[model samples]
Target: MTKNNAQKKAARLHQAANRGTPFPSAMRAVDTRLPAAVPGTPWFRERKRRLVCYCCGHPNLIASFGDEREDTARFELYCENSGCDAREIAVIALSGNMIGTSSRADVRTLTHFPQSATSHRTVNGRYDDWLAGSEPWVRTQRGEDFPCLWCGEMDSRLSQNDVATDRSRFHLRCLNTSCVVREYAVLIVRDGTLGTADRPDVMAIQYIDTPPSSRRTPGDASYDFVAMQRVLDEDDKLARRRSTGPIDWSAATRIR
Candidate 1:
């Protein structure tokens, strides 16, 4: 097929899949390219907003199409959750060159988009420096403002800022309200002198991941009685087996 025909076919396939239709061929693949950077301003620091899964709250969503071009960008994304088939389309307009800035963004998502899916967690290039041990790292005092990895907002605050007992290590958290995901980074000072234990010249930085949140959708309140009945039946069988005081290991065989 021609390039234009392939693009049209991909769009048709996407629409059919959204409508719960089976694909004509399992070998067919969508003619889409992965975006090199997050959709937003041209600056890397401005790419702060991420498309999250609305149904499962997954951080990574696969982009179907839409390249960030001109002052406006459109993103077509699908959930990474195997059990959930949530798809979303978002359009972002850059007002003053950055997203999730101090003035916020003029971005807009689909009406069905849940608030939980709008995450401000974005890591642009800071992590690369952490790995390369780049020089002139951020130096800060306790409770002061620092560059945030997630929101990229200028008004980000640093807390839990204190030097460790080792005198060479320090730690702090990005308490920026604009960012949904909390950021905690470990730092080490080359001078090994944490004067007054307040200010530290960070030489090396390490990013720490936050705890995983619940994947269950907030809107799903109703339980599947049929699935629940199956679970109860399984529990009863397990209870009967436990009544023997221990599981019979000799009879246990791996199922292929």
Candidate 2:
């Protein structure tokens, strides 16, 4: 098909997919290029305000905005790998009066766009050195090594060995051949008189890709810390329940 026809077909396929229709073949036929970066788009402005590289704290480009109100605002971010050509695209929304700040870190977490599926491979360039002195954390326990959270690979190494602040944690890259996913988690420690102890009570999972539409933006709604707390509390309960067994029920609920 002609390029213009393919673009139109892709747009239609996306609309169909959003409406719960199955159009995989049609979607695959059309090229899914990164939406043109516009200087004055709302999503671009929002990214300029809130989007930052989790590793280097560098700002990302506003890749695209939704043609409709409910569709997510898509963005592209560069990775910290100086030798890797991988970029991270995230989707975000406003929660309260704030446009980019959200109380629940994981509520609007990443939804990765496959690297192989994109038109361009990310260029390895050192624009920032956020994880300059960080250590790599790998999965080497007994039994089966947990899949690297970021790239879905079996060889994801931690970007930081020691986390100083609550937000200064590290991420793991996925090892799956075609998936360029990045996963982030935090290690919390309980404060006591003598010394603080590590607490597995809280764990946050951040995506290396775009966040879901429901979570990208902030609105005028009051910051519902209590509601957010409830979500976290339930998450903790679920984790505890799962830790008692070998089967991980959490992975089952991931959005496909």
Candidate 3:
């Protein structure tokens, strides 16, 4: 979608999340004090080119952070797609001696936000278990059937078909009429010398047909490597720029 469309969708999603009139329980639990990204911040730049929504595959997302603690900080990322309920919370563990002394570059750890008693939406089991259950399947050989990641009941119904990457390929689709993710998810396999002589290292990249984030020239991979590389470059530059300065928590919420 265009930038204008993305902005409109973000407004709609925000309204939907904050609706407290008819369905109070439906309203999302968002912290008002969360720090929004400033114009030149790394988070702001990440929102522009990367961070695709897991549900609707939209690029319009909101990135925010909570107050930094002694050795950790929390980040909240949510899609702005009005129809999507995709959001993720990640905790970054800081390295070094002093509190808030380390920059983003100094942080090398990522973990899930601790679950609260009131929130049933957080992962139900161990973080590793949740990842194993939710992540898309990666295949190197044949005979393995790809399942529908979105359809809980009809998970194993979708059969493996071809959608080619380097050498091998596979396609998966949920036949369930009521399933939200009815689109075909293609797993592009990378073959040849990437792996051992017997098996090749296949990278399964999900390609949905409907969303703006999935729009690409025909035959292109799900990711735009060049664009992603540029984003990484920008992140490195931003990290370097912020390395010497102390984080101004009070100034974080201000948007220019």
Residues 3-36, model 1: lDDT tens digits: 5676557757676776733232211234345234
- Candidate 2: tens digits of C-alpha lDDT, residues 144-211: 33333222235533334223322222333333455333333422111111111211121123311112
Q: What is the C-alpha lDDT of each candidate?
A: 0.30, 0.30, 0.29
Over 4 Å off in model 1, which ranges?
1-140, 165-169, 187-256
Clashing residue pairs, candidate 1? Answer: none
Residue 88 of candidate 2: its Cα lDDT? Answer: 37
Off by over 4 Å in 3: 1-147, 156-167, 189-192, 195-230, 233-256
Instruction: Estimate the lDDT of model 2.
Output: 0.30
For 25-129, candidate 3 gives per-residue lDDT tens digits of 112123233244322222223333334433233554445332111112223344455543333322222222223423442231110111111111222233221
Task: Give the worst 10-residue stretch by lDDT in candidate 2.
Answer: 188-197
> Which candidate leads in TM-score?
2
Residue 198 error for model 3, in Å? 19
lDDT of the structure predicted as candidate 3: 0.29
Candidate 1, lDDT over the whole model: 0.30
| Sliding window of 10 residues with minimal summed lDDT for model 3 | 201-210
